[model samples]
Target: MTVTFPHKTLPWLLIAPQLLVTLIFFLWPAGQAIEQAFYQEDAFGLSREFVALENFIELLQDPYYYNSIGVTLVFSMAVAVSGLSIALVLATMADRIIRGQMVYQTLLIWPYAVAPALAGVLWWILFDPAQGPIALWLEYMGIEWDHFVNGGDAMILVVIAATWKQISYNFLFFLAGLQAIPRSLIEAAAIDGAGPVRRFWDIVFPLLSPTAFFLLVMNIVYAFFETFGVIDATTAGGPGQSTKILVYKVYEDGFVGLDLGGSAAQSVILMMIVGLMTVVQFRFIERKVQY
Candidate 1:
């Protein structure tokens, strides 16, 4: 038996609130950013002049902007790969456990409740060169871990913090995906003399492809945007802007430097980049990712 909405007005009314929110929150701000990108205004907004593409032109010539782009790409890939890989392993182990699985899952998932900035702060404390326990241990190992002075160390710090926060989210999805796989498939593989590793690669991994693809896209987006808080808290885009991902650069320039027009241009560029990534995922990657 098929059921449909009784009234046309009811369906529209049901979705109107969500549509209104999207328009107000996303579309409206995006429009403002585009408009602002084409104008040059004083920090206090006392004077304004239209200067189309000038901000973008300057950004293109800025070496630091290029550096930020490179940082963003590296950070996004690192966070996504590390977070997904860690989460998948943990989820697989949890799924295989016949006992205390609930306890393990609860512990794994609770990290998701921590705020991104807080997570960054926690890592900062752990890696603080002066008093951090990890830093002390690293010193004992003859490896210096001062993020305050080393660009590479700063990047590693932020990446670790971001990945740590996201692992819980990826774990939840992967665990669900693993559980949805049929046990009969594995049993059949076992009967065929396949070991656990071989069965996982042949059956379980292929079945989990869809979930992995979804997480990849999500983790990329999170690294690009949501990680701003983590980077800001941990490194303030510092050790000479090495940790400055595009989103953090946008914030640093707009709020701290008060370059509104330039910041708006950067935001527009970022939006285009994210749109292109999404298109690429659907056009190319999505086709190859099994459903």
Candidate 2:
């Protein structure tokens, strides 16, 4: 049965709220950022000068900017890969539960409901060099764990916080994808002498390509943009700028460093990078998706 609106304007009315929100939140801010990128302005906005591409050129020449780019790449990849992999494993385990399924699933998904900053603070306390239990355990194991002065440790800390925050969301999607696979197919594969691993690799995983692809895009975006709170709360892009991902750099420059024009330029670049990444994923990666 095909249901159609009697008037063409009815469909527009149904989507008007969403369109209004997009305009107010996304498009308006994006336009402001773009406009600001072209001008050098003081934090107080007392003086301004139009400097076409000067901010961008300065960023290109700055070693710290390059470092931020590299850090962002590593952080985003670690978050996306580890978050998806761990979530997939957890989802598989959750799907196998014969009883208390909802309880287990709820526990797994609880992390996603936590605010990003809160999640970062939770992990920050867990890995505190002085009092954190995990840090003490690592010390007992002869591994030095200190995010305060150690750059590598700080990177790892932020990555773990970001990945942990995203796992529940990925798990929900993965569990749904796993559950959607027909049991008959698995039973047939089992009868054909295919083990659980074989069946999963050959059938289950391929069927999950669509969900994985979608999560991949979302995770990358999250790592790039939404993890700012996580970084700020935990590391503040500290340990000599080791964990300063691009988005945090925008905040650091704009709000803290008082370089509004440079910050806006960075924001514009970050937006373009994410846009290009999404385009590339759909162009190349989607080709491998089964559906």
lDDT of each: 0.94, 0.96
Model 2 TM-score (2 dp): 0.94
Show where candidate 2 strays beyond 4 Å: 1-15
Model 2, residue 202: displacement in angstroms? 0.6
lDDT by residue for model 2 (121-148), tens: 9999999999999999999999999999
Which window of 10 residues has the lowest lDDT sum in candidate 1? 3-12
The TM-score measured for candidate 1 stands at 0.95
- For model 1, the stretches where C-alpha displacement exceeds 4 angstroms are 1-11
C-alpha TM-scores of all predictions: 0.95, 0.94
Candidate 1 structure quality by residue, lDDT tens digits, 1-291: 998767979888899999999999999999999999999999999999999999999999999899899999999999999999999999999998999999999999998999999999999999999999999999999998889999999989999999999999999999999999999999999999999999989999999999999999999999999998898778898988789899998998899999999999999999999999989988998887788
- Clashes (N, CA, C under 3 Å) per candidate: 0, 0
Report the CA-based lDDT of candidate 1 relative to the real structure.
0.94
